[model samples]
Target: MTAVLPERVEVAIVGAGQAGLAASWHLVQRGVDHVVLERATAFHDWQDRRWDAFTLVTPNFQCRLPGFAYDGDDTQGFMTRAEVGAWLGRYRASFDPPLLEGVEVVGLTRAEDGFLLRTSAGELRAAQVVIATGGYHRPVVPPLGLRLPDGVVQVHSADYRNAGSLPEGAVLVVGSGQSGAQIAEDLHLAGRRVHLALGRAPRSARRYRGRDCIAWLEEMGVYDVTVQQHASGLAKRESTNHYMTGRAGGHDIDLRAFALEGMRLYGRLTDASDGVLRFAPTLAQYLDHADSVMESIKNDIDAHIARAGIQAPVEARYSPVWVPEEEPAALDLAAEGVTSVVWATGFRPDYRWVEVGVFDGTGHPTHRAGETDVPGLFFLGLPWLSTWGSGRFAGVARDAAHVAERLAARAGAPVPA
Candidate 1:
């Protein structure tokens, strides 16, 4: 049910996802008056955008929303897409936040007093606004995709549902990020012939020594590493996440192993024309880079284990199970009976509706931990907004709290004791 839109509120939070809800929780605790505007139903992205077989890449324990942490028995286990949606539902019910569903904020402009939000409902004014819609706004596909044969179906990773939904034939998945790798695996397991185009995204071990790599990284303070403290500086924010999977109790996504199992691997998809696709001659180089990254992570873990004198089980290091002999530069898609293409290319931010000057040249919001130079505006649920986990369930609570505190201070609201 849609909540009645208020004419004015002390705070207006755009997007009722994890970050927005978390911020709302904090604001409620502080006895602040705020309304959360959601374009769709709460947690709609988790339920709609994800594929049927999708599961969390991170462990269940990491789903730490403000005042509500994952309390399930399988703390180390990954939640399926349904489970994630249910969890978020439980969080919302626990708080009964003042939220309006089906209200899209189309434009945001500075008001004489604070800010004016032009929404599907009507104009609402607030003294402060929290932009927590997240970074994945628009799905991106290359212009080369337009040149593909008309018979071939093309879908972005966001729109991909399952293998059975596509035409019966070989499938080509472009990109090797988490979604790409996992989607390819899903198709392969479903008895579909899979051909994957590899990107520069590195792979990582799911588990090492006595724990999940994520757990080890948490212990090593990897997730807590702030964007400013990161060695790569702000560039780390744009880095592709290492590929792994939490499907079937977590495992590594070895493209090499997939290749051995009859999944045709190719380098980056360069161009498409006349029912044919061209690939770069860098399959071996890309694979080696992925392996080296995985090994480098393991090396760090080994060093940490030695330094901490932790007597965990010693394990054999990974050796390449398969290698590319010759880099295939071209594929006749029509001849190979390739029926569909899954472009797991990633997304670009779209804040064109936001008239605020808080964004940088790249259109990413310019903020320090969600606080923009504009006093009444802030951004949240962005990758590396504060730390490695800033955008994930593990760290959004902290970031939301930070934003809520700032918002409260700006509004002259006293935090609860």
Candidate 2:
């Protein structure tokens, strides 16, 4: 049986995280009547799943939303998960964002007026819909085709809480991104023998060298480069550097250095049986090649600075920093008695519930800024929406503001102020 539908609004924003919140703020500033739908009770879904020690790789200054900034002494200090969540909560309260918490949007379809949105709470109609759900909602797990022995325990990085959550044995962390590296380091510190599967070492930024890389990218207009301008799809994808290194000097966790000290550096997990995980020995070699690519980028940046005669102290300091180009030594997990695997392979956005036809061959919506092929339908908080920083807390606001402006110009019935 169908439930009674509720009143309609000008716009319906989905997801109450940073992206959704920014959208709502922009709409409010534009004097557009709207409502926000959220599945969780509060913002930051990762907050519930983040381990106790987790902190954002991007500093708090880069974590600001539109109309507000992080009020703290240490602008470059990375905030813990709890601190971030609290800040988000405070932001929500300050703006009194029209957020309907605990409302799960089950379906979205075009309506005669605009769109009909079905949620767990009730049904509502809107002239336009903005899908602001970030990319981390779905966790990517290991491929099902890969056979694993019944004795081997596997958990996605989302399910991981702490080192104690692992089974009583040595641990194998698959993936070398920030999450994978952090988890591997944590497990090793917890007295568990850890083996990290090498995928590709990402290009890491030196966070503490006076000026943060994110700020530099913003100033240099790196994010403004469009996908169309790049020569190739691979070139476009490789343009941005996503890796973040620890800033606390020698004591900080360096996955590359840690791997060199004895953590296993298997290329990839092919198959596992009889409590044995098989790895490609060439994994370390590939990682070395990846590291060289990063070094080249850094060197290029330094060369450009020298040619431009930029004698700023920060620029001078940035030139001499060394990015290593070697993979860590491999350690045998079986010898150390580690017995579990954690897949931190990242996430993929699923839009099965979004019944729109704007998706491309890759199942992602094609858009400029946040505009979609389907009129009145838009998206925000995507990996790279408008600029390189578009998805970040600081970057999302401008994109959202642009989207709200477009929405205001549409010919729809005025929503009650």
Candidate 3:
């Protein structure tokens, strides 16, 4: 049965994730009457999707929302998914943010004054709409054009938690990002013989006085660059790689090290048969590719430091974690009793529910911080919206404040308290 539709509201925000929550907090602080619609029962997606040993790459000190910060005493610490979820709950309580939970947004269409949002519950009309849903909504699996044999079990990283959840066998983890590396490490630790398909070797940070590389970026205003500044495309691409992985430290667990200890590193999977996985030679080439990228980043950082006349010592301390020198002559799958393949590739943004005509050529919504080309539409949680820091928890508040100010000005009201 179709539920009743609200005739009108001043603003309607979609997806109650971090971005949506941040936007609502700002809207309420400005006394802009708004309602947030979340499809889930709570902020359960990020919490539930994380693996058992997963933690934030960014430390807790940087995990602040608009009015609130992470309350824990550990400032130089990383927060687990559970801790992040708990903090989000506190953030929701602090503002009493008006959130309509379990209401999935199905479609959106342009209305005369603003937009009409159709949801699972019903319809909502609002003068302004903020699409604050994060980037990881859609999971991208390997483009295995050929059909796999029935004996092989395959699952995406989103559904994976631990080795126990995987089918019994030698496991092959595809992708080399934080998720893939961490999962490979965990499964190896659990006594499962593992194989990792290396895509790219990401530059890892060398710990300096027991702090992450991101802390330095925060201090250096690297995260403060915005689209308005006309930053180089290389700068934006490098920023994505820089923050994707964890650094080396006593607490740090290196995936390459884990692979050297037990797991086998293979190139891209070419094809698979009845329990047999084939690989290409590209894996060896990736090491050089990764090293060049890292070298470029190091040079860029050094140049930036020198140009800015900053005196802080810049250093690269950690060595690349060891991988096998040569590919194995033959990887015997039947001998090891391999059974499952976990695709830790990554996620893509799915905007099918978003029916508006604001996306760019690459299918990403084109916006300035949060303002869309369409006046009443806005976006949040996009990568490098204002600066490198704009997407992180520490950076989001400033963007939120900016969006709130713009919204108030559009409404012809003084900035809300």
Candidate 4:
């Protein structure tokens, strides 16, 4: 049974995921009375949504929340989905903040004093509100997906579990993001013929110069790049997903690697109609773009090593490899035995609960470093809110601290005073 929320709170945090918990820890330390509301019971997304064999793309070193950090021996290693869930469970036990689970927030309106929130449990008011719901909410699938044949099974990356769950046939994994790449690899390794639809996403090596690329990035403070301090205007936008996996303690997961593993690669999925699938014929171009991005990152790492005077052993540089599709622009899925489709496009922000004018045309909140134009209104755990690590556990503390400070100031209780 859901408990009735109090009439008012000093601060109210919605979505008790990593971001919400991090913000709650900061508020509790300052003796601020706040409540974290979560629609689900668990604290991390990996606990429920990801596949059984899923692990983090980056190493375990980046799994540091505000008051908690992974102290296991696998700092240089990637964490499996189960390991991540255990870490979050431990964090919940350690702090045990005032979190109300199974409380779905249905509506939020601006009250005269602060704000009014109508939830599944009950209605409540809050002087300050922090939306820690990270950006990945709604899956951004192309409308063309609905055009697939009725017999072809369709599932989004979030709903997929393992290769065994899929029917025995040629599977087409659409989108070349991290999930798509890893899923394709999983199916192929399971002895199933897989087809990958390529996109222009960046890729990263699992290790560089004998040291984990994640550690190298940390040493060079690459994750500390804030929106304003980024290399270019475009860099201020959200960063693309990495292409590394924890299989065999992590390895490069590029398109060429997948092809070498007996997986067929194709260009981006353009359309599907009348049992015919169309591809964009940009496979080579997409490969070149990804290769260029990887090269640039490696160059930066190399320059950083040289500047630090580290006597690290040199590693062979990556060479651009391409695999072209031999098939024509359009093909029949039934003819090729393709029976299932996995869409790994991406996600969009969902904020239908909050009835406010602060949102932009794209439904993205108009904020400067998590602070909205309205007083006592802030956001947390958003990508690029402050730095590259903003949404991840490694970088959430910085943004949480900033959000707490701003919230305190708005309530007439200045923090760090």
Candidate 5:
């Protein structure tokens, strides 16, 4: 029996998220013939997983795809999950990229011609390959659940949709990053007793010096910081999620706020068995660290305003979330009547699909900008690939364009003339 060969194209793009769409945009503009293979119909996998009140941390203006920019009036404001999904969907419709939906790339092998992508639909050979699956991949949930009783309800943040979906009881949200903090708030606001496990994160005031902290980051080129400037690859791989909410013009989302709202606060979740959770003694340090980061951000923003001679409003009435005492390093979830546990722990890329050995020790693609170690292979959505925003909303388009252009230049881009 002979194995069947796959259909070939100039380029094979994996994942139809923001990064993939951006790459598709540039490839089409350059007249390159390509196919964007998407595992899901909707462009955003994380967006669909977000809670009901989820919104982009970046502003609307930064909601840019490859060839299109956000044209709505809420450029400075944040966009909701539905709005972003709709926006990306619209962008997909506007382009003529040969995109196949509901097609999962099960395996990618380096072929003699280019690369062979084994997908649910069929196999495809391409001169170049672009992995634009965005940063968020498989959820990173701990195996502590195996020790717990069968009655406990546990779901990672990626699997979480809203608070209403959970059982009627106190909720325990692990991980204090953006998702964890935000979901804790969601559950708390939904009238459930919430317990938030504190994780290390750099937080900021929703508005610093009368402008959004994100605006300060934009003006200061903070988002453009590259991995080269970072201390190490590990530092570069660190999460940039801020402890702030994108709701109602954005606001601070400190563990302190959740604490003040009567949410039980615990430190890093460590071990769990028989419904008992052990935690690290780091909640106080987390609070102090969050405060320090926020202050540093404010000082930097203030310095930028003064140095740039930018007129800003004077500090008026200030409302601060009161920092509360940290919880003990142990939690009795079963006794506390906590029926639901939300592992807002975030995701890690599952590269088992890619046959290429391009991953570093940190599990990220070893590439300069978007070009990988292999000649024609590239990556677009790793954090700080080109800038701090590379793995984020702002950097996806730019990085995608860069990677697409590189692939095009290498192949003399077989765009339709």
Candidate 6:
């Protein structure tokens, strides 16, 4: 039976993902009364949003919820999509939180006593609300996609399942972030012709100097540095994550290497019209930027190793396997036999339903470590909320704990020990 929505609550959590569930765990420990509202079943995104071949980019050890650190034998291996869903399911069962699975909070506004939430079920009042729905609310597909021929099938990265599911023929994948790069590799590995449009997103080596880049960074305290301590400050939140894959025991995602293996690479997609796509002549720049970023990371790792006097095997730097001699300015879809297009562009934040003044000009919530200017409204699960790991499983635990403590204290309840 579905849980009935409560008309009022001492505290309300607007999402039930890892971030919100972590908060619930902390609240439960402190004996704080709160209800968690989830738009769908818990951990639905982990099971549904990812493609058939999707594996975690981060290692299993980073799966650190409040009381649920990964206990599996393969601590260094990445979890498959189903494994991730099951892990989150186990976490949910461990706490049995007061969760309304189908409750969708459509609108939120300030109430006289606290905050008023207009949800799909009905109106409810929460003295303190934790918005943990995360930043990826909508998939961004450009309007130019419509200009392509009607016969061509276009799918957003969020909706893509696998190469076998797409129409037979060559596939044009536009974007080179984590999703775009990995998806292209998936298609290429499946013996499908792939045309990948590169972007400015940086890349990272999977393993370096006899250790995973993530492990090295962890030992260097890179993930623990607060957003305020970084040179970019809050602006660091806008940076695209460096791309690497944990698929098949982990490896670097080198687009140039993919090019050497018969994958067609192009610059950023500028426009599409009359069944023809135009690309900017910046393919070399994109590839060069990605390589430089990877090298910079290795440089940092070398410095850390030197400073710590750690004995690790020295690894040589990467060299480009293939480089584009001349940029491909345009491509006719019909001529190239491209039957499908995948728009792997990133998402934009959508807070139109929020009727509060705590957001900035860019529609991002303005907060100091999840505490908004609005007294009882807090935003959690945002990238770089406190650190680079704020929105990720590796870091959400700390952010959730901090938010739960603040919310409990604000409501005159005992804070978590």
Best candidate per TM-score, number?
A: 1
Global lDDT of each candidate: 0.92, 0.71, 0.73, 0.82, 0.80, 0.90
Which candidate gets the maximum lDDT versus the true structure? 1
Sort by TM-score, best first. Answer: 1, 6, 4, 5, 3, 2
**After superposition, which runs of candidate 4 have C-alpha atoms over 4 Å from their true positions?**
231-239, 325-328, 412-417
Residue 5, candidate 2: alpha-carbon lDDT:
35
Summarize candidate 5's per-residue lDDT along 52-169 as a digit string, tens digits: 8898878787777767889688788988888888888788888866777788889998989988898887788998999888767788888886777789898988888888999989
TM-scores for all candidates: the values are: 0.98, 0.86, 0.88, 0.95, 0.93, 0.98
Give residue 59's lDDT in candidate 1 (0 to 100): 93
Query: Which sections of candidate 2 miss by over 4 Å?
Result: 1-6, 144-146, 207-210, 231-241, 245-253, 312-336, 411-417
What is the alpha-carbon RMSD of candidate 2 to the true structure?
A: 4.2
lDDT of 3 by residue, 123-149 (tens): 889998888787677888866724455
Candidates 3 and 6 compared: the better one by TM-score is 6
Question: Per-residue lDDT tens digits of candidate 1, residues 61-124?
Answer: 8889999999789999999999998899999999899999999999999999999999999999
Worst 10 residues of 3 by lDDT: 241-250
| lDDT of predicted model 3 | 0.73
Q: Flag the better candidate by TM-score, 1 or 3.
A: 1
- Name the candidate, 4 or 5, with the larger TM-score value: 4
lDDT of 3 at 43: 69
Which one wins by lDDT: 2 or 3?
3
RMSD of each: 1.0, 4.2, 3.3, 1.8, 3.1, 1.1
How well does candidate 4 match the true structure, expressed as C-alpha RMSD?
A: 1.8
lDDT of 1 at 382: 95
RMSD after Cα superposition, model 5: 3.1
